[model samples]
Target: MQKKVNLASAGISAEESQLFRESITGAKPIAQDKIPPVVAPRKLKRRTDVLAKALDDNLFYFSDEFEGYIAEGVSLSWTKSGDDPHLTGRLRRGEFQPQVILDLHGMTTREAKAELAGLLAYCAKQHINCACVVHGKGLGILAKKVPNWLIQHPNVRAFHTAPKTWGKHGALLLLLSVED
Candidate 1:
C-alpha cells in the first residue's frame, strides 16, 4: 500500500492542487496496473523452390528461331488477336505508364528469361497492367528475343516500342492482362 502525502508539504499551491483534483474528479483508477506484452509479427516465407520449378518447367522452352527477324533501329509492336485494335497504339503512345520496368541489360538470354518470368509473375501478383522491358541495342540479341518471349506469354495483351522519351529503340512497353 502507498502512503498519501500532503500537497502543501510537497510545495504544491492550494489553488493548483484544487485544480488538479477538479480535473480528475470523475476519473476512476485503472483496475490493471501492468501493460500487455508486445509480440513480434510472424515473417512471411517466400516459395522460391516453387517459383523456380514453375519458371523452369513452364516459362522455358521459348523458340530460338522465331520466323520474323526484328531489324535494328526499327520499332516492335504486337497485340493479341482478340484484344482491342487500339491497344498497341495506346502502348506506343505511352498512354499506359509503366508500373514496373525490367532492364535486361548485361544479362544472358537464360538470365533474361528468368527475370522476365519473375517480372510478369510479380506484375500478376500485384495486379499491375503496364510494364516496360529495356533490352539494350547491343548486338540486338535480347532486343529480338525479348519481343518473341513477350508475345508467347499468355498475360501479355499487347506490347509496343516505347516512344522517344522512354528508351525509344531499346525498350518495349507491355500491356498485361490482370483479370482473374
Candidate 2:
C-alpha cells in the first residue's frame, strides 16, 4: 500500500495562494504604445595612450629610448668577444641553422620586447643554441631595438644579419649560450 503525500506540509498555505492571486490581478496589461523602444548599445572608444602605457608596464623596454634607433636599411652584426672566430662567418653564411625562430614583424615595440625575452628564456630552458629573430627592415625600429635587447641579454652570445637566402637584412641569427 502507498502512503498519501500532503501538499500543505510542503509549506504552501492558503495565504500564499491568496497573495499570488492578488499579485496576478494587480499586474495590468501594458499597452503597445506605452512600451519603451529598444535602444542600441553605445560603442566604447579605445585610447591608444592607455594601451601603450599598459604595454610599457610589463615589457622590458630600454631605459634610454634614443639608443635603439638605427639607420634605415643598414645591416647590423655584433659579437661580445673576439674568441668566437667562427660565429660571425657561420651566422653570415647561414651555416648554423636556427632551432627556434621568432618573428617580430607585426608586433608593437612593447609586445616584441616581451616576446624576445620570453624566447630567450624558453631557449635557455631547452638548451637551444641557434635561434633567429625576424624583425624586418621597415623603419628599423625593431631592427634597432632587437639588437639592443639581444646585446643586453646575458644568454645571447652573438647576433648577425641573415644571409640573402635567409631574409638578409630583414632578419638576425642569434647564438644562444647553453647553461649547465
Candidate 3:
C-alpha cells in the first residue's frame, strides 16, 4: 500500500536519486557486472603552519620536569628513565669504582671538549661503568665547563663529587650508560 513518490518533482537531481535508490535497495545483481561511477575526489587543503618555533625546541623542550642547574662545586646527579633506585646511592658510597680516569687539568677548552666527547663515546661503546673526570679545584674553565658538558650528554647517567681520596670537589665520578 505504499504510495508512488516522484523524487525528481521533490527537487532531487537524477544522479542523487540514483544514489539514494542504490542506498535503499543495494545494487541490482545485473548492475554488479558494471563498473562504478568515476567521482572526482574532494580537494583537501594541506596544513603549512607549524607549532614549534624551532627544530630543537620540539626535540628538547617537551619535558615539563625542570632540567635543573649544575653549578660549580655542587654535586650533579641525574638518573635516566628505568635506572635502579640504589645505583645513585652506590655511586655516592664509592661502591662503583671508577674504571677510567679522564684528567681535564691543563688542556685548552677545545681540546678538553674533543677529549670528553671521544672518551664518553668510547665508554658507552665499551660499557664502562664508572669514570672519574679530574677538573682541578682552582676556579678554572674546566671546573665549570666540565659539569655543564656532562649534564648535556645523553649517555651520562649520573655524576657526583668524588670521595676525598679521588680528588674531592676537584673531580667528578660519572656513571656511564651500558648499551642493551
Candidate 4:
C-alpha cells in the first residue's frame, strides 16, 4: 500500500512511503510490567469521632509498622481506625487477620470511627479470615472523606466498593492482616 503525497518539487514518489512502514514493522509490543497500577477512590463510612481518636492512640504502640507509608503532614500520634495493616499484601507483615463492618446506617461518624478501630483490633486479635463492612449507600454519608482516611489507615488490607448485593461503594469491604 503506497500512500503518495504530491510533493512535486521534492521528487519523492508514492513508492517511498512503503519503506517508512517497513522500518518500524519489527518492533516488539511493550511489556505489562512497564506500566504502574491504577487505583480508584473507594467509599468509607465515618460516623464516630471519639472512637477514632482512641484508635489513633491505640496504634501508637506499633510505631515501627507506620514507618514509611504515612502521609507527610499527618501526625504520627494521630491514627485512624484500621491503621494496623496498611499495605500488608506484599510485605512480610506476618498473620492474615481480617475484619468486617456491618450495617452502618444510623451510626454517627464518631460511632463509625470508634467502631472501625475496635473492629480492626478485634479482627487482629482473633486472626479472622476477613470481615464484612456494611455501610449502606444512603445520603452521601461516608462518601466525602471516610475512605480517604481509611486509605491512610494502618490496619486496612485492600478496600474496594461493595458489590450491589453488598451495599455498593457506600460500604467498604475491609481486609486486615497483621502489622510488620
Q: Write down the TM-score of every candidate.
A: 0.67, 0.62, 0.56, 0.44
Assess each prediction's global lDDT (C-alpha) against the native: 0.85, 0.78, 0.73, 0.53
Q: Where is model 2 more than 4 Å wrong at Cα?
A: 1-73
Off by over 4 Å in 3: 1-68, 72-74, 81-86
Model 4 ranges off by over 4 Å: 1-56, 59-99
Put down candidate 1 lDDT per residue, 1-180, tens digits, no spaces. Answer: 999989878999989988998999889887986888998998998899987788876575456665443544477888888989899898887799999998999999989988898898899889999999999899988987888888777888988998877798989899999977
- What is the lDDT for 46 in model 3? 52
lDDT of 4 by residue, 125-149 (tens): 7776455566555765544334544
Best by lDDT: 1
Please, what are the lDDT tens digits per residue for candidate 2 over residues 34-91?
7678999989889989866755543443443546435444567777765486787778
Better of 1 and 2 by TM-score: 1
Supply candidate 1's per-residue lDDT for 114: 85
Total backbone clashes of candidate 2, pairs 3 or more residues apart or in separate chains:
0
Error of 3 at 76 (Å): 3.9
